[model samples]
Target chain A: MGHNGKMIRKKDLTFLQKSYIPEILKGMRQTIAEMFKPKFTFRYPEERFRPNPSFRGRPVLVQENEVERCVACGLCSRVCPALAIEVQASETELEKERYPIKFEINMVRCIFCGFCEEVCPEEAIVMSNEYELVFSSQEEALFGKDRLLKSAEELKPRLEFLRLNR
Target chain B: MQSLLLISALKFVAFVAVVLLTVIMLVYAERRVSAFIQNRLGPNRVGPWGLLQAIVDVVKLLLKEDVVPRNAYKPVHDLAPIISIAVALSTFAIIPFGNTINVYGHEVKLMIADVNVGILYLLSITSLGVYGVTLAGWSSNNKYSLLGGLRSSAQMISYELSMGLSIIGVLMVSGTLRLDQIVLQQTKYLWGWMPAWNFLLQPVAFITFVVAAFAETNRLPFDLPEAEPELVGGYHTEYSGLKFGLFFLAEYANMITAGAVITTLFLGGWHLPFAENLGLSPLMLSLLQVLTFCVKMFFVMMFFIVVRWTIPRFRYDQLMNIGWKLMLPLTLVNVLVTGLVLLLIQ
Candidate 1:
């Protein structure tokens, strides 16, 4: 029985060696076929290749009226996962309203969760489809009131009507 | 003297044209090949099938800012890539791309210089390629750069031994160190069917050589030097714009060099499969031979791309073990076996 076991072991070794060469050849064949496989790179400038509508992009503040939607509620600041949003409010003449005097959203801190958009009661903030937000410095990443207001104005036309009514 | 000077100048210009054109087209091919493998469309928006993308890329690279890192060892860091690019361009001087052709009533050899020790010269210069990688890594002074340089040094030294050993088997059978002579020796066939390609006769040596060449070129599976995720840019993380472009250029140039060397040594450079002794005119045969050499190189290059996409990269330890344990021992045994066979036949 020991002798038979030794014979079986030797046969197994032979089989293993024989199997490797053909398996390796099979791998080579697969690689040759992959030479003709389709590539993954997308042409950026032309053919736009727009992402799906559900594709999450850079977040921007949506101004519902000529007034800022933040209303200094600070709920966005509270719910912010990255603590990106900051709101400094003061009383205003329009219906005893509180408006953010100094509003800033640090884009580097943004997780693009749309959480701030969901958390807003006034429906003032919504993230638009403008995903191209590349910057060379940290300062540029911190969008201040002026920059955010300008971006909000640019996105004002695209905001939904129900949110506008709110 | 003036006419002689003019002739030599023209030859130089012609070599430059071919090398530059090849680099551009090869870049395009690499992009297209990679795109195909990843299931995406390559640069098709430019000219036909993105042919002009390479030209546009070159122009853009040239016009881009050449930023030198403030912390870098400036002179050495700057010169390292230049040395690499120069060496890559210069190595072509010894490679014979085609047969003699007449231009302006002057007969010129296709090669720049066919030295007696052409193979050794090729090896020596090719080995120096590691220095560029090492210096770029070290000079950058970043931890990632330092690691990249250190890995490259170890990797190049380990693989060079195996690469050298692989060629020894071919040298023993061919009985020459000269590349031109090696090609001449490969012209004859062993039987009516076999094409005298060294790959058939010494499969072990061919495999070792090809694998070692992959390592030598710092290609994938052996591309630990620039392993991106782990090392960021690896040796060249600090370099930006055209300075970075030089390292990129050197990588492709080395790929081309490796392809050419493999073609000349094993695949029967420029010789047709089974068409030897047909009594064709020397000029006509030479032309056909050049075309054959190109086809072989192209096929080998495609093999490089395929392996790159198909195989996952080797871990550093795994790469080291394969080089020293598997490839080195196997190559040495191959060399010994080939030498013994040659001795017995003689």
Candidate 2:
């Protein structure tokens, strides 16, 4: 049978395969072997999985030198498919100009698609390796700038990976 | 008569307690074995290596809210799980766990009841287990539950024919229906080397019986009744809280019963080869035999769990074909061959 658009015919099985006994035995043997193999389970709470630099986790505002790198650019908010990010621009005394007076990311609505991070021209809203996002109430899930901001040192690996890849 | 009654009562209590405890541990073992087969760590949080997991589960079940559907038949829904568990637990009564032991001046058998028609009693009681599932399904007023119950009952009936036929070979070989006598017969060695286990003599019957037993217990490769992808939860879909817990307990209990049956019928019960030559006292020997039976039962249970993780559930039509088309005829052939051989030898 051709791999193209042609109709594929079923291959004739060997006597052993047709009988199914050999295949069954082989399967059983494989499973028994797997029983002795090392388990890949990570015991949560006691142990955590450390994601690589390429891994996208929770979105965070990169804080550098006692100030956020974001100039209140609404690009991240506009690109967010979930409509999770909300920003209010305000005048700033800094040379770069406007800053977000109030910025909020509804952790509940955020789909972790990294669209906000991708659209941010300022490189401020990058994904941080903080995957454990638990909130008891709807209000608690609405992350303000206080919770959303992370120091550049904390997000260095992801930022480095992004810069190298881009 | 009073003494005999008292002894029987004591034996019954002991037997039930042992079985219930084993069933609890067997649940934990099933989970752990399944996890190991899939290369994952199972429950290890409740107690030491999760030894107290069963206790925690029982407590959780007892505390959970019991939900009964408005449209469901209340009495039948309530009665179904009780029947399921009762039948499962009752099957152990006729299974001879060990030989007779002398204590002080009296002789005591390890089994609860030494019934003359032990195998017949076992088969009949096990057959009654289908009622529990069927009633549970019919009373639940849910299509999934009804379908599951119907499938389970139909599967049990189909496989049961093969199972019974397979056992006919064992019956013919042993020449006795009494379980203790069957075990005694198995104690004889073939040419002073290999144990005369029925598994050696009736390999085809053993395979068919094992396949049938797997179907009867509703384990994987034959678990079409409770196929989670199709039937949701089969018969116990509508049951919740301890009522659902009862069904879970009943399934594990049935597995243990199946394991015990397989061990008794084919693996030579508790008769260990060359056990007599150890020169141990009668009491010690009886204890050793009981230990042997438990060991064999444990391995059988492990095999059951392993098979569950190894094999995927069969399609409904394939399950039916295997039960009727394949296993039935094969067992019939096994019976005929065994009968012919026995006649020739005589």
Candidate 3:
């Protein structure tokens, strides 16, 4: 979307434009004015940024009542491009009948692509707004079921977003 | 005589300490001002408003390994930053910070050195600064460094002409080469109100001189030598640790000296307007004069930082064109006009 058209030649400039001083003064005034404008930088740790619901952060499994919403169908694990998700299905006495006995996510490999969330047949996995992820070692990066699961109330916004969109 | 020598030594120590401290503050100010202009908070973590960041940075640099490139010439590479820092620091000795005040029954002049040929000393000392950058570039054995050094030499030499010519306008008006005398000339009231500062008397010279100073100092818009995107740290590309820190210190020191020089020559150095009539004590007045000089120098430094953030670097051809075709001729004409006006008034 560009025109390979006429370019401004030196001769085309007016006396003011040719001088460069006026333009420089104009720019200086603009910069001086800009110095007073409120800054956009978050003071980071002290002042955290609250990202909008649309923002796709780290993927977390949604837990409802006393159990996770996942049916252990392996759809999410199969769809995870990074192969970060690991789920072991086991028979449950609850109404869902089958549940993941062992659910782990290698946070290091998780791309946060939301693909696993999209491919989930159950309304189980969703992207949460927890962007600050730091791990000291490879082992530290691996999330077990305890870390991976977020109570449905905690992930209400994301769950609601997925439900409304679907 | 011994007391005079001791006093001079004390002044030397005091001034160098102040200059070093100011350079650190100037670096921090430059970063903060640039960030403010760009709508971001820069380096506010190290201390209160990041005031101690530069001090911490110096310590960090000191602790880091002194890296020397395998292909680099050892002796000159070691010598360059020393030369730059030394030249930058020495230029400030001639700038009068206040009028002579009685200290312990002997009159002590405010500046470190009272050179009779102060202006000539300033010009010569500043001219030597180019050697440090040029030598740094040449010794590094890096193509980018060499280009930066070569550009710096060319820019400095070209701008030096206009800088000297512009100073001639001030010289003609003041009718003296001594910096203190020039300042004294400026303190006189024109029409009983406005100070007859060289900036007011020779505005064209002020403009040209300020422009040439910008070029000489290697600040942005005239910073072709250290254009980071092109030259990758310019002459200091191969320098690291303490050597790199010295160069950084020298650049900021050069800026302070330039600001001091400008304040001395044009803005009426240490001459706080109408303070003599305020009925203040001589000691208080003297202290206030020194304070005035510092405030003026600070504003000039701020202007330098602001201009750096505002203007984009000139194209190499445009830099040369401005230096030779525009600035040189303008300064020559300004000098001529100043001479004519002086003659007419007389």
Each model's DockQ score: 0.31, 0.60, 0.83
Q: Which consecutive 10 residues in model 2 chain B have the weakest lDDT in total?
A: B101-110
Question: What would the per-residue lDDT of candidate 1 be over residues A1-166, giving only the tens digit for each residue?
Answer: 2465544443555664543445456776776676576544556765465554344566666554566667889898999989998889899988737888988999999998978777788766776666778889999999887766534556654455335543
Clashing pairs in 3: none
Q: Using TM-score as the measure, which candidate wins? A: 3
Model 2: per-residue Cα lDDT at residue B247: 88
The runs of at least 3 residues in candidate 1 whose Cα sits more than 4 Å from the true structure, single-residue gaps closed, are A1-25, A34-166, B1-8, B100-107, B274-282
Which model, 2 or 3, shows the larger lDDT?
3
Residue B235: error of model 1 in Å?
A: 0.6
Where does candidate 3 stray beyond 4 Å?
Answer: A1-7
Cα distance off (Å), candidate 1, residue B142: 0.6
Please identify which of the two predictions, 1 or 2, would achieve the higher TM-score against the true structure: 2
Instruction: State model 1's lDDT.
Output: 0.80
**TM-scores of all predicted structures:** 0.72, 0.90, 0.96
